[model samples]
Target: MTDWWLWLYVASMAGGTMLFLAWWARPCGVPAIEYQVAVAVPVWSGLWYAVLALGDGRVTDPGGQSVSWARYADWTVSASLLLVALALTATHALPRRHPWLPTTLVGLNVTMIAAGLLADLSAGSRSRYLYFALGTVALLGIFAVIWGPLRSVARRQPDGLHHAYVEAAALLTLLWIGYPLIWLAGPSGAGLLGPTTDTALFVLLSIASKIGWGAFDLARLRGLARRHELALAGRP
Candidate 1:
């Protein structure tokens, strides 16, 4: 059944991507490229989670002739992530540090994308080091956003709601990282404790991130509206 779960994961990811892209493309007015990339991040993230599911286990023959179902899933996921990253970069999302504090996030995640792809390629290597390194890079990328980018942004602008939004994004980023770890631990029958702890952490992180960032988004919007109203009244 890992194979079955793989298919399920793929289906859900694909379906979600299609739906989201369709919705994103529907609006006639041109949206900011970074915003578009931000919206698409979840889809790419979901696809990666599916790959993690596939890579968690193996099905092989007695002669050691490997059937590479996991590799195929990994390739698909890697290709998708690269494409999305490229799209984001092309749309000017990659170098977002301009005019604002230099966002190191794009640079960091680009490294992550590279490391993940390299690890996927070296899956046949005798050393599990490649896997460990890729995971490390990915995790580091997330933490950097939380610690470096979020902290700096919050400090520069102590606006509480703005801080909240950044925190939320950071939390979501962690969840995106955690989902795979949870699956790997659980499906491998490593024990309930490991998987449960990982899942719980991810879920909590996700919840906190959303709540904080959502409030920030709302607060910002409200501030904008109030300012606009004041300007309009002054003009009259």
Candidate 2:
């Protein structure tokens, strides 16, 4: 049962990586940094998912909880790239308070996920819930940064780009918020969702979040680049 889901996830990741790379390779005058980050996010995410699939979707922790450490590793790198892409897209609009604000936020977000993973691996039910609470707190902090500083920056982008940024952020946020709930329903929590359903839910979310968002961002960048080229050509 779960094997089918695992294979499907692997296939989707492979297909998505190919498609994303193809779009990424096309010529676009968008900032190289933005382009690189956009491409890297999904590519790396797919790679990690592939690794997870090879390992039969997840590993059982000491407490007999099914844990996807590969997914955590994926989030650590890919999530930071997602932020970097957002930051780069809004570079001109971001506040000048701190040069390393994006990097710091990325680190914090990765730490939050890592903490949650550790909590899921804990032996006792009480520890599981406690660490999960702590992870949730960290998630709230990350959200504050996004909805606060990041939103401010995004709002200053040009109309089309601003809309794109908002869409990307909204989609990513929606998928991410569900993750904690899924955790609660899985082996570590109430065990209501069983491994198969839990694995399926994650696969669907990963497709929507990483692959879908990457494609949208790539299209937005290409459109912006085209408009810029046209504007430059029309200049006196």
Candidate 3:
């Protein structure tokens, strides 16, 4: 079941990658970096999905569960690109403080994924929950960065960037809440749900978070660019 679902997910991601690339290829006037980063999100995730689908992604966890380590790698990179796209869209992110806030956001995202991976890999319950707690903390840090400094940055921007950032961040944060919840209930944690159900939840979440969210973001930003309300982002 896992293999079958993973293969299906790989196909979905492949299709999403092609669609995202095609969208990016169009002469949208949005910032090239944002569009390009949006494209990279699915491309990278698709490749990792392919790796897992090929049956090379399984690792025997200390809990004797078959885990897909590649999924963690995929999340780390793809989610970071998502953050980059968000930062590029909503903030001037350059020529000041080395774009520390955006970098900090990405770092927090990576930390969250890494900790989740470590949690799954851990043998003992104490170690696993410890890592889970760390990941949750990192996730909170991400939210803080978003609602804190990133919000402040967004508010100062013109061209409807403030509203855009708030909406995008809200969507992303809402979607992200599912990950740890699913992980906690799935085989990796309490084992309240079976692996197949866990995979299904994750797959659905990935589809919505990556492809759906990316489309919404790029499309809205493109509309803003067309109206000449977009600033700081490079126009075609």
Q: Kindly list the per-residue Cα lDDT of model 1 for residues 171-213, writing each as its tens digit.
A: 4464456534643353222335443354344334433332233
Full-model lDDT for every candidate = 0.43, 0.74, 0.82
Tell me which residue pairs clash in candidate 1.
165-213, 168-209
User: Where does candidate 3 stray beyond 4 Å?
Assistant: 92-98, 229-236
Model 2, 6-46: lDDT tens per residue?
Answer: 67776776777777667657757665556567667766777
Ranking by TM-score: 3, 2, 1
For model 1, the stretches where C-alpha displacement exceeds 4 angstroms are: 1-31, 42-103, 113-126, 157-161, 177-180, 183-236
Summed over model 1, clashes come to 2
The C-alpha stretches of model 2 lying farther than 4 A from their native spots are 56-59, 92-99, 234-236
- Candidate 3 residues 125-159, lDDT tens each? 99999999999999999889888887877777774
What's the best-to-worst order under lDDT?
3, 2, 1
Residue 53 displacement in candidate 2 (angstroms):
2.5
The CA lDDT at 207 in model 2 is: 76
Name the lDDT of candidate 1.
Answer: 0.43
Error in Å for residue 137 of model 2: 1.6
lDDT accuracy of residue 17 in candidate 1: 48
TM-score of 1: 0.45
